[model samples]
Target chain A: MIVTEKQQLKMLSSAEMQLLHEGSCSLLSRVGVKVTHAGIAALLLASGAQCKGDRIMLPQDMVKNALAQSARIIQFEAPDPAYSFTVNGPENQVKFGTGGQALYVVQRTSNGWVRKSAGTDDLKQIIVLCNQLKQVDFITRPVECDLPDEQKDVAKAAVFRRYCSKPINLANLVKLARLAEVLEIIGNRAHLSFIISLVSSPLVMDSSAGDKFVAIVQKDIPVAISSCPQGGSTAPFSEVGELLQLNAELLFGFVLANVVRPGAKVLYRGIPITANLYSDASPRWCQPDSIRRVALAAQLCRFYNLPCCGTAGVSDQAVPSAQGISEKVLSWVYEAACGGQYINSALGMLEQVMSVSYYQYVIDDIALGIVKEKFSKAQSLAISQLALSAALEVLGCFGIEPDEKMEAELSARIRHIENGLEPYNETYIEDQLAVIEKAVNKSSSTVFMKAARKGLREGYLYKGARLDASLDLAAVAERLESSEGLGT
Target chain B: MNKDELLEKLEHSVVMGHLDADDEGYDGSMEGTPGTLELLEQALEAGIEPQKLIESFRVAMEKVGNLFASEEYNLADMLASAECVGEAMEIIESKLQVGNSSNKGKFLIATVEGDLHDIGKNIVATMLKGAGYQVKDLGINVPAQAIMQEIREFKPDFVGLSALLTSTMIEMEHVVRLIKEDSFPDLKLFIGGAPTSQAFADKIGADHYCRDVMDAMNKLEQVSNVS
Candidate 1:
């Protein structure tokens, strides 16, 4: 619990937290999210939500009520506490958590489809960066891969096997079911909060997607509910209005996830951005105001007595530029403020969360360090009076009017700063960068890669674990046709 | 070419990157004629060069990049765009050869073995080309010795190496050091990928890091000025 001055200014109060919660709920119920999966819609209809065809709309009060009931602090420590992190509650400081950092990150990726490249490291950098930052909650897609590249989507999903303590928000559906099937791959050791996705098309869940959704239920997987919508795209353009649409859609996803995997956990997820013209190619969620607003919106998930997952930190810059810094910070800060339980994307991600950069990842870690210093809460004084006295004497008494003595103290303090003093140290960035290298080189890769490879070799998690090693040929052919035949 | 058409082809080329399409281009193929350079020149001669052509290629491509914001285009589009840009670059490249080459310095680019993704490598190449450097791309999944061999033969001012995988990013470091330890002691090596960092660069002793195109340009300019 290291607190800093900047953190003190940014801390949210209980009442403020509740207002945010209510506002988010009001938005969720009034606007309502689309339910893409029909089966999910049925589940919500069976619940208390209002049914409109496939769409199950939630009421404003219902959203507010749900927000109030949702769990605020999720003690995320595993039964083995050693590799655990407490999914922090609001008021307890934190940054944001991202879904993942993929191999094929982009400066701009909006459409659901992206030409998959085998083993893009840009995504990996995001995972490491998010992992390096204290504010970020999850580290995902920690590796590269081979083949037609789309299965690499699963690689983003696959890294979860290595990070049980930090539950991963993998691409929902089949991957979720596969994760459940391979629970032993992770040895039931890690806590995985599965992402059960719903439609942005109101409230209908896809039948096939539902089958996969139900697989999580069958496995009794802990699921998080999300109905992400982009204005004029997956959702209407208005922020609150869009939230309402998603609320209904998400509620359906939640009910389906829980009906199958009863007691499966849920975390509300959303995007606070505008859309580009006719194409769904890009979503503008990085505006500072939008990020802040989304932070407030994520509190509605808390209304459900569940943890919240709010995304931020995707930049359009392929490298570490002012734009990258701005998008990354807005995203991270919003998630932290929203009191999200799982945060990712503090590193190695760019564009609309499409590409990754190793160097940029290093730069992101540097930014995270700077931001952490900016937001860390100041702890109570536990040091001795002697230390306090010496610390104070170094730069005190120079507050208002700088006299000769004050000038002398300031000069000495400046020298100390130049020489790497406490509070204001020398290029901690260099140290930070060094540590990043070590983390990427010495630590993160060697141990986990071996595990991931071994995990898949020994057999990976799949939706219908009827276990078909014989299907290798079909998979290969399917891969070849998608890659070569499509004429990309 | 109109903005839309230019963007479409440029996006295609970037997605379809080529490292060894070597030609001392006395031709106009790099102008993206959808075929080889000989055909590309014919396309360019139909009147493709303009400040608008250059700047708009970047702008339209970026605007096409708008798909990234609300989750429209996705990572696949990005890869496609990157490859497409690579193709368009080929076309632009031949034209560059025809003009007073921007190549203030010569750079060599490659990917380490078992690393097939070329997104980062293409970016560096394009940026270097944009900044007026004569870049020789070695393509994806290259071996360390190949780089050393390339250096021995070509004697480039800077060597840019990329590895898309963390497992392979490690190999980049080893090769960077190997270039110094075994051969090309004077080679200015730059390493990038998702896993390698500035700290990694310093620890492994890579002379410089091209954090981005602009940074690489500035770094190259500075390096040349010093020499």
Candidate 2:
């Protein structure tokens, strides 16, 4: 786990937080939320909410009760229990993972980088890469595959089980009904993690998304209501408006999820992207404005006593160039310093979350290791006081120089810290490439077949055996075993 | 007020983003002076030339762009300015023709399909209009067929495509190909956005690659002069 030091910065004061909370509460009770799913509307109405058409005005007391039902600390279980991560409470740590639903696979060519439509092999390769990278604590469907639209969800489930053991966080790209089929297969498995429950921008939950969340909650799965409110378009142009609307949306989800299953694991996932004033398009997440907005959202989540999910380290560059490096590094540093228990979209994504690169994934894993070293470790105040007294003693002696023994000791300690620092050089990347090569070599026919058969089992492993022709698991294993190399 | 004075106030209103006397400017000031739309009415009632009024609108919008570029203003400021220009243009569109048509020509712009970003597109449209070109904005998520339809009906001298997302930027190539294959062979085509570059323009067979709104204006002027 990535540890953090005590925070010395506060994005919002108590009064400001109180005002925002109260404003959201008032908005929830007054303007209400438009829930497109009739079942969810019925649940809210049965629980003392007033409904006018699609809008459901939840009572403040009911919202508070729902808030009270949240889990302070959510243990995200992986297939291996050692890989599981907690959401909030005393963890005070950050975990990095890949996030995107991009259709393109940005591959390095002989000339330069070129973006091509991602195939199932590309998706499987991402899972294999993340599985070996220790920095990636969890896995999400990083890139969209080239499977037919109807077969998307089952394809993801089949591929995810075949390669990865880390907890999975799924996007909302799959059709709700098909997504339910996929989830039912992984529902009882030890590796099944939370789903990214998305709500519409500006306080509206569409029919399908509402039903999806309800089904997810019915399965007793954890849901993180990740809302993306672009500053100028879907949300109000002002920062205040963005903050208020984002908070209101999350709170609305919190209420809805609890109403579906009280005490369900719900995380407040806020992704506040800033719009470029000239184009009204969001720049990369590295912008100071975007970071600041996310920090405020984290602070609001803290006030509501809800776990926060955030995105950082994504770049708008199409290639793994200097621009991509700087953007990803700056964003990781900012989010690490600020607040976020689980930093989504922290690796392997580019072009504003529109593409993923295998080379970049390996490079980003190395970059995150460097950034995590800067995280200050927690120390006892008494130990700090003793060090301070020693400093004072040295200061009391003014111009007196230390002996050679003392000087040597100080130099040794400095060297220790310096030695721990690993530069993200070419050799490091080559080393990671070697690791990927080793991983590919190990995907033997026997190992691949075993995992495939286990994942394709009845309700215990997966549901619905409507496998696609392109996803021939045995053929994929054969191809990987016989291919020359990844051609990195 | 005198005609020149009224026009000046109209320009100031656009720069300040005062839609009307009732528009509370970005600041707390509610200067009771008539806004750009209202002052345009006053200037027209005073029998001021429509081209002259449009010229003032152009100047004000340019200031808005400059302020935004310099970081002195923001989205709300430029949007307010554009909204003001839109309101005034609606009033004088019938009376207005492309002013100084000997020097400039009409331009059609759109954000290609699958991209819902129009802020950059809006900036270019407003800047082109202010630069004395009759601009038709097709707004966001415009399919290639729709853009081709507009090109046929509007017969613009230039077609500009904007795409903020890389996924949607691919659509620009399709749009460009369709336009080239269609009857509009002489139609000058350009592309711009956060993800677009000169290399992309070359690969897609577009005539010009604009880095920003200012670059777009400059290139359009150069192309207009050459053509």
Candidate 3:
């Protein structure tokens, strides 16, 4: 899983990263994050964060101290012991895991693709299926249990304990009160971890997530303080603006994590995806624009030398197809090449985290294997070459031949990711910050969407030609049929 | 300039999504000039009729709507124009006589309990206000009790509920049930959010399921036309 320096994709130079870090610090100290939890606010205030109305502003020194005090190497222990791994901040190792809070389970039927409501049984089946998938290094709770709010945490933990042997990431705690019972059911805190979106977009902290984060960190459990800001919606439409806000939000989590428990095992999870402003403002997960921003986020996380929990391969397509496979391959390659140590949502996700398909799981396993193989065999090759080659090979395996138009589209995508769309500078960052501040102050993302009017007219989002060849899903179907515990 | 010229400027400013003299507006260079607010105030000071200003707002918003539909403007441009009309309506309402104002039907909007998402709700509220409706924005994480209380007090003709999280969808259904159980039979319930669909609306007994801001506007317009 280690990516060599030659194979690494460096989207931002050190100077650019420094500017982004400085901008993040400025945002934290200036705009600040709204902390609704009084106790957390008090804790932050006591820890050198100034109180500005409802927001708690972290100074540069405070943020730097928190960064220094955070754990550099986070050990993700698995129940099987042999599957355990450690994510070192300075290492180039990348691990892929299944992750999502998908509401539906998609399956290919004789009639068509059927999407049914995902329940606790689907959680068990997914865990069992992923346990056998060699490419799945760890297992994240992909779907929430169909239980009452109070019972969900414990019920989901029990299901993972009984079915999964890999490192278990109960993505989020539904109820903080049930944490004790959930941990007791799992029986090993070492084998367990959690993901908390402690801060909402535009620097607003979710009170419930804050409470859960405090409890989990206090328990000495490894957690990924995640922040996903959809550009043109909750964040600025520009990549620079979105990254500044995203970095600020994640840094706020790190400061709070250190405040809660010094050296708290927290990974930097920043997914700076864009909103589909051309239509419904829903999040575009694995589109080319999102792929670029997410890869940039990974690179930035590496710049901070933080344990990176990257997100990729969450396909935007509703069903598994050639376009989905191409998107997943490119996303996985770029994210891994950019130093994502512990990648999540790397398999089975579809429809922008709305659904997970069983067939898609096997397909992702194969496609990811192809990607990792390409990365490992790569020598003196740029990330763009690795991505394009891997994507073409993966698509060819899926019975998709990239026509000239599609090849040109893929080449353009690689070029775009290789060369960023926006300039990372002081003036640009300040303007982006102003847009975010406007959105936050007004409590509406219309400022961002309005700001994006020009960009949309200029094709800010990649409108590439899709690979329309019908996917030969025979291998996927065979794998799904032969896979154990899928109830197929 | 003259009153007619001032009115034309005000309308133009709204269409350009300018708020005040400080606003950069659509093209980001219109700052430090007479924007919608400044122009409206000047027109009013120059003895322009409030009804005439209202007519200008309607015309400007219609143009903005067309721009948005044609992809020349986005949600932000539309919202900016709507905000101009919304703020102008507040000023113009005071100038007009009681019950003779150009106000449309009252609309109440809120994100359901346990959900802190407000972008969708805020956009809908601003757009409704721009469309000449008297909108009451209850904001995010509003509990069912608070929403019901607001419904009773506001007596809105339409109640729009929003919840981005599936967990809060239940709360949305609960809010809808509470509203339905009340005596306000003429109140139309509209539900929206990522998880909401026509099926969910039907199951929860909501009168309509808005897919997005445009969908909400279209449904509201249909009801307005029917009434």
Candidate 4:
């Protein structure tokens, strides 16, 4: 899937993006990221990063140099050569893939929707089901194996090799000691990729993930350095603040990857979602605020011309419904239009990445097909207009009729996505940095949550009507009934 | 100001979630004002009894808890208030007699081995501290041996284990086994994190499973009352 030149949506102005880039550089130089791995810290220190105790502070030149040295285009090879794809930084190409470390499998039974713990069997069935889905360009491990830690990597890799013929993304390497065996089981590194959250939120380098990332990047394997900072908790609640922090985290990974091995194939995956402060403080993955921030992350990745691994379509709704589908349609459209090169977690995720549904996979395939069709015919159409039209059409197909209120709510969402919520100035960025620094120094998000009080009062999060009508899953059921190896 | 007024200001500052003179308080506009710490120091200098100050903390925190329960205050507000109380307790702890400590109980918490995530653990720790518990956070990725050693030395009244990943959840079970294998009587074990549940806690022999910080506090309070 490719987002054409005409369909590309630029949410942030060029000046705003430049300011964000400079803000990231300033944050890297001033506050710095806490690197627990001594060897990796030494590598970064030798490469012009200043050492401030445990933190490794990279200079602006070091960040720019690392960005220059990183590979701009990455080739994702599949077991079947025809399914392989290339993600070029300068192009508007987009690829959708299944993703999540979902814990439960949601199935609609005669009684009601029941969620069962997902295991190795669910992993195999998901892979088989995704293999037949037309829109899933790649397969990121959606569920973890029930095996012990030592055997998990190898077991998951073996399952992928057996059931999935598309590009395989064995999401994370659980144990570094088993990496060799897992690679051997796959037999070809070209068909395999991985995602590592190398840096935790608020600029803390995860020591375990750091080790795995070093080992994987040393082998020249394609990996995405992901950083998911939930605003109002792990990150600043403001949009500008969260993006600045998220970008700095991912840029830290880029610098580390280049330091370990220059030109290491790494994708920039930044998911700056928000926490629902109104309730349980749980992450709102597909909400309007999150959709806007995630789309802006994709846009910023394109601004750096880095290979982007975007996250979209992870619904906050626990069960499959009209609301979930509506959220997914809007998320996929905005993410792709805003320049996500290789989007992961784009299908079958539900319950805010806690669970996945087999029926939702078919529904997403059909919904994504509708989105792509809208994009193909979207010549000279504004992305917001196209998104609204596509979402309405998809919902109508699933027995949903959008009333005027729903349309008004969606328009408000689009307007929010199109506008900047906070000022992108040096003073504002400094304040945001101070908030992040306070949280990091205290080793908690208390400062962030405190700062979020104002944002919440001012309605930083979107309050819109939910399209909560039940989704007609008749077509989805029919498609799943015909699909092979689902074990239904 | 008089002792009564000073104590009143201290309580108000805490309810406002103000920490020090630099804190912005709950609404981001109270940075220049004297905050909880300043007001607490003032009350102490004014010859207010440490026990009275402890009573004020309890009152202010109860108000914060009510606000949080009613959804008038979010986690950040509650956490900020908790942080204020936590910092204030550090100051007030020195003035009290040996047996007159304000701590409700001692808590030892950690994110189990192989888990680097700590937001949940940090929240629980801060809340426990704010709720008048003497908390020793062992931090993330702490091995069972270190936890056991800490148990021997610290002798906490409660132990809370946290793990975000399922892999580390297994480590939680392992840590629980090691703790149970030891002869630590009257030390209740609690498990929490995104992956943990009541079923998991029951299977792993933990005394309780905390869904969140409030649940941890409420459950600990309930157990305290019962015992």
Candidate 5:
């Protein structure tokens, strides 16, 4: 049963794939990404990555050697082995990467923000949302940050007493690293993540030094890879060239990460889409072509058989709107289709990894479902062929010849209808709303919310890993207590 | 010295990061070199206008920002570049004040409340400020009211906001609404970072969704011209 569909589409030859892979490697080694970590350079040099001063030139052999030791796949287990990014939970298995969502606060009164002091209740709510989300397979975590903002200036040293007790970005880095360290600390916990940047785009040796908090975890969270690319203003005005050059640096980063961790779960976050045609106003993300190129980038990583990350669900919009959807949907499909193991970026994320929308989590979760759905296997072999045979025997293929029967059977045997991100394409969104005779005369969602709130208050049921001894939890508690007064 | 020669000198100064008393050589450590007034004057003397000289400096600074944004360079290098750029700009500022005024426009940008990751916001701001725009950088965790108050006080033509976390992005909707309600309705609202898009901008009624700094400036200039 030959469907003969897309047969002549000329699938990329293994040679072509190899070429792309080599190109990435060469780009990385020859141009090299920027380096912020001294440890990374030492490790790369130790592992035979040709280093000239600060910049490292890693040959393809190094990349292949490092990748050979990479863990092919991993499964995230719940409640305990929190270190793995996996798909081995009780119900949902969709793991989430860090989402770069835009637009954090909604305004309250004339000049006020509707902020709920991020606390236990808020943490619990996030957990609940993660659990309830059908799209989320496993939680991407060390989910901790955002303390309440106080109007009165609190003492800098009294950070622990004045504001809601929680770690902010760089502050949270150490706490999250500890969380990572404890969670099934796999790969190289001793080495720092390899960081490489572009020569042209290079600031200097050891230029960017953030994310060092993860250093305490002993797991080399490889970073400092130059997204050094010239879209229009800086480099050639070609998307493909931009991708190749960027991928080259990123691939070098991969080698660096691998050199340090030796096939560790390196995050291959792609940063493409520079300014368009000499003008900064026409951002490449706003263009459809840019989205497709990013998608191709996912496949590019796959061609190298390396774990991939970055640039999906990210949009060029200032807020959640029409332009956001088109960009995200296009790029997300590329990510899902290209088999990216880990990726993030919110539907309403904007301005190049700066912000994300609040509702985007829920909305993007649904969008994530579309990506997760691609991994879903639909097999008709599970359905009794005999049962279908009887129904087919009664009617037959209208006017099909005997030879055509085999083709039809083959088509039916393995038919894949590409449901391109139509969330709930088959069924309308619904809940178990009907009342039964045994049910009570009334029902209340608020009551359920109340019970959940109580459990959160007790602290026995749920409490996320706390960090930052420098902050106060009192204000957060008070704010959580009066959250109902906050959200409209 | 003319514009080309001045640009070359300024480029060297920016790269080298200092100047001698007679403008002979770099004065500080190899990496710790900071920009100075002499460099700007030399750049101006080369006939490169103050604006172009600053643009050259910005070009150099953006490379640093790009490295930071992509995780190529670490935070220290990034902060150092910021320091270098700041010093360089002081020279640029003084030189401009001596003769002309360079204000691209009153551009207001901030990292919205309930979010604290400043790398992206800071990077965008650096590029904007580099381009000679009067960037009123409202530091991280800024409330909408604070933004409006600044917008009122500053009378900025553009309001820029950034967020880093997903849960916090929900807060941006209010910021947008506040600006609309309290500030100028016709205000050219531009936003960016990860999780923002053209569609999201339309959804939230933002004037523009910028991906990169070049895009931000280009769109800013187009949507609402700065006189």
Candidate 6:
């Protein structure tokens, strides 16, 4: 049975939400969004938007009409039906999944945990772990594989599609050359998955992201339009101002996608990141403001009846320490309780979402189980649960004796409830770890290993082919053979 | 404000990331006060030495950099301070006579090919310029041929290559190899970036690895004294 939670926390009042939406609509109709791509600009212009060069001023009514045409509930298709889910709408449930583009992986050592650049082998391990864990509902590109700069995204998608049967959230396919291969990998499962297109915050749509977005949407695949407006840096410092800017950016994409193909399946994702005033870092999962902003984003998504996607379970701590675990759990509770339907980075992330930890993956599963259990609806009490006769017999208030068969039935039922509540303990976590270990030891999925073995060759060929130059492949192969393993 | 007061305000402006007299975006308290660039020009107009004016900007940047290191200031703060320095440098560049401060050294800097990041490169360039080095910034994604061409014409005492992307750092090796093979074989090559390390620098045959702008300046001083 799937676990679901209904949000009781209203971070924003109705009037405030209306004002925020109106402010965004004003920003759209007034300041306008900068569309860097010529084709996107033309499309918007043709669709009744006022375009002067790169800036496209979208009419408020046009935006509202576009939103009206969009799907309230879009199905997130997966390779298997078990992993399939729906996002947006009132029926959306809080689901945990892996988020991506991490450059490094954390590994345990005698001293402590050390971080190393993630490569193809780490990518495989990430997918395999996500697949083995019943907790992870879907998979995004877990870690950016250390492959040739030109082919990493395409190669990662290919490898992930082959091994992981869950739904995938494709990272921004910036390179046009890799699009065809990625599309082929997605094939008929377009509904089961979606590609992401990011907008440079403070109201700028990158031309490359724009082109890739159109390309994906044109193929009938759902697209997630995500914008991360960093407070005090990219957007306004005030929370209200930041949300307004974030909403405006997301609405711009919604209008653009709908203009291209009306009623296109789009997930309105807002990542309202907070900038650390003392540090140069844009902390992905930090304090009061980040969680508050997340809740507010969900509230806003509820206003639009769209599936809310945001970041949670992130940490500034490098390792799985008290600070990391506390921050992850806090963000998880707030995001889940406040109606975040598709919470990104909810599992297996550490170091401010820069690195993925294998151990942290198991720990997060247990944490997720606890949150689900705590937030799950209370079971209704029945006459059997009252246990009036058993209570009277135990208290010696009645002359009648308790039935042994009924007593045994109650004990069995009590045991089932106790078992359900005990998944968060260390023993259960260890069991999940052992399952992952067994899966890895089995080596049933050799696709990632195959990719790792070909890393040097593919990198060399891609770069060499670009240069129109030839290398002594035999010599390079000998060097690769003698080297230490990738992602070590 | 007096000359000393003006100079102190210049330092405060950068620390606060205030650009001009009316620049009120960051801190409202800084509004209506003369910013770094305005005070710098005022100092120059008040018969202060161009060297002294440049020194004030340098001291402000030092404070900003320290704040950055201590987590008291962020990237936006550093960037805003850099913008103030850039504006002041442009103002002071016209007043200063050439060859007055050329004795320290001359340096050419560029982000290696296929890498578009130049935040670190720009900061280093500004710091080196303030440190009395004649800096030629080739901007981002500069190919090896451009560096070679500039080297042939500019004849810099040192070349600093920056690459933020690990994949593009390979291009730095090519640049170093080509520059070493050129006629100016003694031209010192220094490398720095997010992915660059002392080990990578040594393997790429660079003369030095700069952990940050201050490190680069310290190594530059050492090179100047030795040469």
Error of 6 at A295 (Å): 3.7
What TM-score does candidate 5 reach?
0.46
How well is each residue in A1-488 modelled by candidate 6, as lDDT tens digits?
22243234555567767877877787778667777677788888888899755668899998899889876777777777678887756754777788866767887667968988888888887777777666788787777766665887678777777777777776556466787877776665453345454456556676766777777767667667887655544554445556777888889888877887888777777777655433332344545456567667777877888766756787666776543554565566666555677777788888776788877776677656655554553323222232222222222211223356434533443222112111223343333233222322332111111111111122111110000111112332343334333234
**Which 10-residue window of candidate 4 chain A scores lowest in summed lDDT?**
A442-451
Stretch of 10 with least lDDT, candidate 1 chain B: B19-28
- For candidate 5, lDDT tens digit of each residue in A1-488? 01011211112345544555655565556545445467666766778877655556777788777667654443333332333344111112223443431224221234532422233333334434444444443332212344332211121112212221121111122223243433233222221222223223221232222223224223533333335343432222233344555565565555545554564555455555544322222345534445444545655655555555435666655443333443454455444444444444433345455443334445455555543333342222222232223223212212222244443532232121111111211111111011100011111111111111111222211111211112122332343344332232
Q: Write the per-residue lDDT of candidate 3 for residues A1-488, one digit (tens) a residue.
A: 88998887788899999999999999999989998899999999988889878978899999999999999999999999989999999999999999999999998889989989999999999999999999999999999999988889989999998989899999998889999999899998899999999998879999999999999999999999999999988899999899999999999999999998999999999999998876668888998899999999999999989999999999999999888888898899889988899999999999999999998999999999999888888766777888888888888888887787877878888876777778888999999988888888887767787778666656668877777889888998888778876784
Report the C-alpha lDDT of model 2 over B108-223, residue by residue, as the tens digit: 99989866556568767765665667788887779999998988898899999999755566789889888878857678998998767888899989999998766787899899
Instruction: Point out where model 6 deviates above 4 Å.
Output: A1-6, A149-154, A282-284, A377-488, B1-18, B24-27, B59-83, B95-227
lDDT string for model 1 (A114-193, tens) is 43342534343344344444434555443344433335445544444533334454444333344433455455524544
lDDT of 4 by residue, A1-488 (tens): 77888788888889989999999998999989999788889888888899888988999998998899999989999998889999998999899999999989999899989999999999999999988999999999999998877888989999998888899999999989999999999998999899999888889998889999999999999999999999988899999999999999999999999989999899999999998877657789999899999999999999999999999999998888888988998899999999898999999999998899998899999999999988887777889899899988898889889888878877887777777667888889888888888888887765677789889878888878877787788888999989898884
Global fold similarity of model 6 (TM-score): 0.73
List ranges where model 5 is wrong by over 4 Å. A1-16, A80-98, A101-124, A141-144, A148-237, A274-287, A318-323, A346-358, A367-488, B1-227
For candidate 3, list the clashing residue pairs, or say none: none
Estimate the TM-score of every prediction: 0.45, 0.69, 0.96, 0.97, 0.46, 0.73
Error of 5 at A366 (Å): 4.0
Categorize the docking of model 5: incorrect
lDDT of 4 at A31: 87
TM-score of chain A of each: 0.59, 0.75, 0.98, 0.98, 0.55, 0.75
**lDDT of candidate 6 at residue A287, scale 0 to 100:** 52
Candidate 1 Cα deviation (angstroms), residue B71:
24
Question: What does the interface RMSD come to for each candidate?
Answer: 18.2, 22.5, 2.2, 1.7, 22.1, 19.1
Query: Of the pair 3 and 5, which is ahead by lDDT?
Result: 3
